[model samples]
Target: MARFVLVSDTTLSRNYRSVPLLDFLASAPTDALPNAIYSFLKGPPPPAAEGRAALAPYAVRKLEASLLKHYSKDEVVVAHEDHISEFIDEDTEVIGVSTMDPLGLGPLTMSYAVFFETRAHAYVQREFESLLARINKARSGKKAKLLVGGPGVWELTVRPEELDRNKIDFAFQGEADDIAGDLFRYVSDDSGEKTEFFRGYQTFNANFRKEWEPNPKFISRYQFSKQFPALEEIPDIVNPSVKGMVEVMRGCGIGCDFCEVTLRPLRYYSPERVRREIEVNVRSGQSNAWLHTDEVFAYQHGRHYVPNEEALLDLLRAVMSTPGITRTNPTHGRISIPAAYPDLMKKMSSIMGAGRNNWIGLQVGIETGSDRLASTHMPNKTLPLKVGPDGSWSDIVWRGTYVMNKHYWRPAFTVQVGQAGETPEDNWDTVALINRMSNSSLDNGLPFEFTVTPMQNVPLGLLKSRDFDSVKLDQSQLAVYYASYRHLAKMAARDATSASSDTNVAARYVTGALVGVGGWVMFQQVKSICRKGGLDLEKAARHGLSERPQVPSIAVIR
Candidate 1:
């Protein structure tokens, strides 16, 4: 039997506990055919399996189907680095390296110290070098082919010269599930034309199939589990509700110039399928459900969007009617619904006890208020104002608070900014929008907690096209945006202070405005230097926001 070995750059010990990579490799159907599989998980396994159960059933199902179809189950083996050499015998025919890289999307933690302290890019490079060293050592007298795949290998930053120097035989982008079959066919061939035969082997198509199988169990077990590994560790405030977490769809149709979700074709799960999954989770003792999707309202089956108003209402009624489960005391405490479609928002609010102390909250992507800037940059998002009668935008804060006060007695919202293709005009519009929202919140007597996340775009795949220039922060733009943000923050602070006492109202407002203006001046200074340095606005923003460590030491890999 042909022997194959799989190696991952990720610390297997730290990240792969619930549905370990070895589990997938071990489940492959290699023995039924002519192969023997041995998988080695490099690095530390993940801490715990606390949060993995939250992934929707549909995702988990897909992952399992793919694994079973590829490699033989009994033929597979798993080990760490210390035992890697023991598995690499002369019979080994292929060595596959599963390398993943961080996409430079800021720190996983919001803490500034952790953000700058972690060198994700450097960590990736070291991992690659280490894998190459292992491959070279294992190559003693065996004629095994070396294969590399994963997120890190697909980077525009990785130069061809580096690959050439390392002498990697082949690299797979996106997915590597089908690589084993192709490698098996190539190695088993007696003809010396093995290279020629393998050159045309369908790596991309095979990998895609292996990656996109429709097993709900696999998707539930892998991605979701890994994303929130320790389920039990989560605070009760954020714990799963009675219904449990369920994914309504996958992928997004909106091709926001700055976003990555648009790169893949959008595929949605059916409402009927969603209902079935919900029932499964409830039966399995899950209380709350968070519907996961890039755009929840975009879910369409065949000719129509599933759970369109009437259908969603029916689904909610059915859940509420489930014996012994009250709509108010749902097994799943809260459902985090997306505000992509205003109609969906209205429907969700109406059925889930809108304008009351309801457990559900809506997440709307109000990227910016400026119609022109939003249209140019994030065209995929339907502007609230652009939708209704006479171009009237929805009062999100008011509605959010209304719902919270009526149902759950808590107000929550998430606001995102710093899209990849944002321009000076776009930034100005964002500033204006923030100010307007903050003011509106106070005027309407709404208690809302706004999370302002400033994310700089990273160039990747098709998005690396030359049409969109990278944003570099110039002194002027920086000054303007910072001033605008500070102005809004001060306004919020003043509003809070005013609601308490009237004496410091004037002083607080004046001080806030002055601090905002001063920040603007500093921004101008930085802009002038950026212009002299011939930097692009996007690039400048990345440099300014990137956490640059003082000593430039490599991250301490555990």
Candidate 2:
């Protein structure tokens, strides 16, 4: 009988590491391993879970599935890391290492210093190299041929050029469902058939499918508390709220130029299936559960859209009617209620307990105030305020504030600037828009926070066709961007300070106007610097600056 050992590169767990070893072992032929051992690096448990869960059962079940498909169940020996020290014997002909964790750098660190000091990318590289060295040394001079596989290996080894400089005999690089039969054949044969085995592995590099099957022996490492239970104890980890996570669907349909989720076909769960899952979790005493999906709002059940005004109200009513159920929230994707669909937004608010101290908060991506910039860069989402022919800035602000106060209490909005393909005019428009929004929030006493996150767009996929030289910022434009950021910070701080003072209405309004005027002056200064440096005027405007130098006679807009 051939002896095989499987080592997990990182701490063994379900969420982080995706090596389905249990399924593989269960399906493999019993003759593949008369004696076998499994080991894990065994790091501290997740910060929230407290590390009490044993990942061995889950790994074993995956291995068992593969073993049962070919070999008898009795042929495999399952041993944990602690058990391996007592059973290190000869005749171990094959050693398979699960390189999923090490390669992906699943939130674990080797040293306390490195964990705190090093960047994520550097730490991942270091851990991967270290794991590779360990595997090499362990197999040194042994007759056993070393094998590596896991999620990370699938990506790294799909192309032979991407492999480590050191030779790895065989790498199982895909969903290891049916791949185990092929692996068993390769390990059992004495005739060095490595080339033939790897050629079969190449199929994953071209095309693949993700298949899921229930493993009976699947065991969780932690025993969840009855009061504040962990997420894993409840079915899946898709859209999990306090109640449980229910998978609304798998994959996405939108082919956004920057997204990876759009690569697969969208598969949605039926409403019946959703209700059943919810009932199961709620019966188990979960009050708050999340509906997991890439886009929860876009969930289509059978032929109809879920939780749309009528359907969502019905789902909420059903969930509320359930015995002892209190709340339900989505644990995935930002919820956006289109400006044109204010009635729907109002309907959602009524159902999901929106308003003061409610669990639901609308997360809308208002990427930029500039409609033109948003349309050019992030075409997937560009919703602007609808204005009548004679509508003024005040009209827009008043309507926006009215919408926020009427529909929801906590409305989280995101704005993006400095995206690739953004011109100087686009940047100016963003700044002007932010200024208007901030003023409106202050005037109306709405609880809002403006998060300005600057991102440098990297050309990938469809973006490769764009001319980088034309869109790329010159030295002056770059300097203006930096200056604008500092000015925005200062303005925000001034507003905060003014809002804190307990002054008369007139005094408060005067202070706010002064702060606004100061901000406008700083904006003009940045614009002047850009002009002197020979930067594009339109680009400078988009950054929230004017071409004219700051003059004492010129009055700042109130």
Candidate 3:
């Protein structure tokens, strides 16, 4: 038996059929989606060899690598969820699980709960509970300590009692790349010394400010400087990660008031470091590189949040030049960068070999379309391009989408509802933006290739009480949801067949068909909900079509 066993929640272990953005399906409420379909869509778990997962989530892989620096390969095991029992025995000193959105109170998960009007646990929460049950069962008579950590650990801090309910010994917060060995030893030995660590977790306020509260179930770095590991301190993954993921950067410097990612200091990985990590994934038969970052454009950025085009280009070139990398794309970025630097986007697209058949997908947080909200919540998001001087927030987004589609980049946008000081008109603005973008096309007559997902800003108090039904979506909010779903349904019907990554022809076709039909059916439900909520679907259908911008002539490869 291994001394330290690490695993990730089931949702993060699968490939989601390798379809872009399909991973979001795991956030759907258990009561809303059927089990048969969910299981099919999530695909099979990663292959295991002697109870060890061949590919694990990137976060768990990082933790595993950190432990390996001190522990021998035989002493540490990254176990598959199904075979965790095989690794746990009396000698096992600690069982570490990495999770994202374990409690399902995350913005996207809560969005579904509020929209669906159900308090049922999301698939994430359900799978986490089930995994905990399995772990507890495996370690029933053993002396192993259950340690849960990762980005989702914050949810546990919000509901600290869950630590006891789940039989978790400690929920660690913040980055532990530099101190993983110390942390493991502390947990394994049940240390009471608070010299390098604290006995509490950190919380963020409405303004995204950090606060600490005393809690024995939680452990975190004592000093803020210790929360983020410097570039030299962080170690590379020794194994392949799910989706061929490799971290390119650590924090987003945009400083969006509503975001906590901005709190961490920025750290960029050199192009050489990035390529080394990609090589590890390639050795495991992954040809596509998924660069993980809070903001891709912020890599080695200049003053005033200006994008360093040369740095970004070098990074892309390095990724593509890797031995087995056939494609590459960043995880997240801001729209204003693409809007203000079209030439840079075109150059990067050429380097990545992007085209109609090879669309590059990115997740962007265009939280709101209203300029008032944009200026108030995330003024720095539009750094290089001022809202009034360059264009309205919607206009900037429109031009950015146009440029991206022209260069074969499809950004997945997330908009938020119920933000601080949000008004009905703000939601209507969002609906109008979605309608206009959905109706616009590229120079090659291809529809704008992108997706818009609506997220809810659930208050902490409500999240703790599980009183989601009390937070109802008004008519305008329902309109935003309707408009977003309408556009998503159209995109699904058009791109599902082409975007699927399954190698088997028959399986790919079936998966595409299911995805397309599922989108239409989901949109129908949204339409019914909107009709019952007193939203004017017809009016929403034509909300911003009258103001659709004319497509400018541009040489773009289809």
Candidate 3: which pairs clash? none
Computed on alpha carbons, the lDDT of every model, listed in order, comes to 0.39, 0.41, 0.89
Q: How far off is residue 318 in model 1, in Å?
A: 9.2
Q: Identify the superior model by lDDT, candidate 1 or candidate 3.
A: 3
Count backbone clashes in candidate 1.
84
**On lDDT, who's better, 2 or 3?**
3
**Best model per lDDT:** 3
Ranking by TM-score: 3, 1, 2
Candidate 1 residue-wise lDDT at 441: 34
Segments in model 3 whose C-alpha atoms lie over 4 Å from true places: 547-558
Query: After aligning candidate 1 to the native by TM-score, how far in Å is the CA of 193 from where it should be?
Result: 7.3
Candidate 2 C-alpha lDDT tens digits along 1-558: 336554444333222111111111111112221222211111222222121112332333344345556655334433333333222235565555555433332211211111122223323444345555665665566666656666455334223433545445655544343445556456645465333233333221112332222211111111221211122222321111222445566565433344435544565555555666666556545665456566555554222222345555565565555565565555333222223345655765676676544535334444554555444544443112222331322233224434544565333343343455666655555555544444434334653333232334322221223222333444433443434444454544544334312124554454445445534654565455456657665543344333421111111111
Task: Estimate candidate 2's alpha-carbon lDDT, on a 0 to 1 scale.
Answer: 0.41
- Deviating ranges (above 4 Å) for candidate 1: 1-64, 76-169, 174-247, 257-260, 271-291, 301-307, 310-366, 383-422, 435-446, 458-472, 475-558
Q: Which candidate tops TM-score?
A: 3
Model 3 worst lDDT run, 10 consecutive residues: 549-558
lDDT of 3: 0.89
Q: Per-residue lDDT of 1-558 in model 3, one digit per residue for the tens? A: 699999999999888777878889989999889988899888888899888999999999899889899999999999988999999998999999999998998999988899988878899999999999999999998999999999999899888889999999999998999999999899998868656888898897765667888888888987564578888989999999988999999988798887788888899999999999999999999999999999999999999988888999999999999988999989999998888888999999999999867888989999988999999889999878878877788988988999988898999999999999999999988998998899888777778888999999988898888777789899889988999999999999988787578876776887898899989999998999889888889998887677655443322221
